[model samples]
Target: MKTIIYCWLFLFIISFNLYSIKISVGEADISLRLTDTDFTIDNYNFDPPIKETYSVEWEAIDNMTYIKFNYTGQAMGEKIARGEKRYLVLFSK
Candidate 1:
């Protein structure tokens, strides 16, 4: 049916819109993905071959954006155990 074909086409287009950006920082390779409401970051280290994912939520208020995340992993030859951080960014335009 034409309806079934349209549904499949819509799903195919939506899947391709989701993308990620990858970058290397020091000994870690990080991938970041952003959607309408939230974003996620995946960090992978080559030396110890460890991978960790950090999921966080963001909200925009006027010209400022807020982000908060809680993560636990290894860092700088030592274990992070547990840590959390909050960030506020202001945009100028």
Candidate 2:
């Protein structure tokens, strides 16, 4: 019984890790975490001059997901911008 529990626990851990995606560029970080019905992306900007945060919500549709994300923290839409500016993403699962 203990061995069976340990095997199940290990498989759960591995499967959970397989669905998470993380990417980092410079001081900005983006991560996508998947759940049963939907997924959420957390965007973090850790730049020295500016620190901002954004969120992306996606819903599953058939074999794909639809996301409309935008960043609200910007320095007057200048050279340095954050997040998606009226952009849409269709992620295929």
Candidate 3:
């Protein structure tokens, strides 16, 4: 019946949304170190570090927007050279 189909579709949509919990992350200033030549490198293997997994959060205090992400990833893949910087990002499902 129509009622059963509607219920099933609604449940399906809800479950799908729950699985992802998409969040958008953006900021003006983010920095990361440089590669090679630098004493600090990912795992010290001379390879690019893997992108880290992060939990996203946001806050607003008197017109200042603050976004924070907790990294659950290894620092092995994220290394820049001296006096350099890079933006780190990740989307979770």
Name the best candidate (by TM-score).
1
Q: What does candidate 1's lDDT look like per residue over 1-93, in tens digits?
A: 000000010111225676443433334454444453333333443455333434455657886666555554554556545555556633332
TM-scores, in order shown?
Answer: 0.40, 0.38, 0.26
Worst 10 residues of 2 by lDDT: 1-10
Task: By TM-score, rank the candidates, best first.
Answer: 1, 2, 3
Candidate 3 residues 1-93, lDDT tens each? 000000011111233343222222221122221111212112223244433344334445675533343443344444232121222222222
**Whose lDDT is greatest here?**
1
Arranged by lDDT, best first: 1, 2, 3
> What are the C-alpha RMSDs, in order, of all predicted structures?
14.8, 14.0, 18.0
For each candidate, the alpha-carbon lDDT, in order, equals 0.42, 0.36, 0.28
RMSD, model 3, all Cα superposed?
18.0
